[model samples]
Target: MQTEIIVAGFGGQGVLFAGQVLAYAAMDHGLHVTWIPSYGPEMRGGTANCTVIIADEEIGAPLVKHPKAVIALNRPSLDKYEPLVTAGGLLLVNASLIDRPVAREDVQAVYVPANEIAERLGDKRLTNMVMVGALLGATGVLEMNAVQESLKAHLPAKHHRLLPANYQALEEGAQIARETLAQAA
Candidate 1:
């Protein structure tokens, strides 16, 4: 199985970090993974997107022109990357920031209030984790428990104490996904 994902948003939205964590989690699951980030001037308030490729076999390319999944944290991200997602793939949008919905029918568009959830969790920085949760729940790429374990491995020693918060954020995001999907169904 091959999974390509693009996490795109503004510069400070942790788009790159989200890709890194997903890549790391894929690697931990014994899959080949590659992460590519658009940096420098392109990251300044514009569409800062990172591509993560995970495959059971060798990955041919790291750049994802068309991804199997897209996590768009902002309106610009959705407007920019929504078309690139493959048919029957997954699209996770930050509903808190985007007003319009995806018009595509081939893919599943999941709306998650990641930023709002992070704010309610008392640390807006956990928006990335919240999106991670939605991604996990929507695509079943990684188990929730495995994601929690990966968080411990990914966070630095200085920020180790915040592991609990991140875990909670992820769980909350996943729960939101579940509820939203249920309502949509």
Candidate 2:
């Protein structure tokens, strides 16, 4: 089986990093994976996104017409990818940045206040991690431990001091998703 996910938002939102982390996790598990990043003309504060595909066998290509899942960190991304999620797929929205609600009933949409959650955790920059955690919580596509390990292996040494906070953000985001999903049950 294969899962294709797209992480999208403004450039500085760590979209590429988030996708890469997922790819790293897949690779660490011996799963075949591919990650492709797309950047807009403008850099930080501009549009940026990445597509990650994980499968049990060799991947044929990285291109996808409609992904199985999408993490939209901003309104523009939600607007552009909302209708592109395959039916019965997943859509994780950052409620802190997106004011509107998910319009697709065919997809399981989880809205997490990533920015607010990260801010509460002491760093708004950790929003991407929060969303990543939410996706794990909602779908279990990847194991939490693997992701944690991936972060530890790849995070720059200079930023290593923030590991505790980053881990906290992941748990907090996952908790939110668990609660939300429970309520909808």
Candidate 3:
């Protein structure tokens, strides 16, 4: 199983962190993975993005021209990355920050209210976690248990208190996807 994903947004939106968490989950799943982040001038600004590859075999390239999934956190990100999603891929957008719809029928696009959900959870910074949850629920790439464990390992010790809240954010995200998709179906 090979899956390529792009997570992109402005700098302060935690796009990289979301990629890192997904990468960590892939690692914990014992899959060969590579995380290639956009470097140089783009990193200086909030326009951060990364490509993550998880596969059962050696990855041929780290640069993804087409990805199996996309987590777009802003309008610019959605505009830039939405076209790159492959047929039957997943696109999880931060609907709270971006109010656009995917223009492709080849992909399954899910709009997540990350900022609103995070705020409701009492932290406006768990947007990444919210995206994480939607990604998991939408794609089923990793087990929820693996994600929780990865969070525990990836988060700093001082921020242990956030583990539960982060988990909550993730669950809320999943629920949102479940409810919305169910309704659509």
Q: What is the TM-score of each candidate against the true structure?
A: 0.93, 0.94, 0.94
Q: CA shift at 38, candidate 2, in angstroms?
A: 1.6
Q: Write the per-residue lDDT of candidate 1 for residues 78-121, one digit (tens) a residue.
A: 99888888888888999988999999998888888888899998
**Runs in model 2 lying further than 4 Å from the true structure:** 39-45
Q: Candidate 3, after superposition: displacement of residue 25 in Å?
A: 1.5
TM-score of 2: 0.94
Q: List the residue pairs that clash in candidate 1.
A: none
Is candidate 1 or 2 superior in TM-score? 2
- How far in Å is the alpha carbon of 6 misplaced in model 2? 0.2
**TM-score of decoy 3:** 0.94
Top model number, lDDT? 2
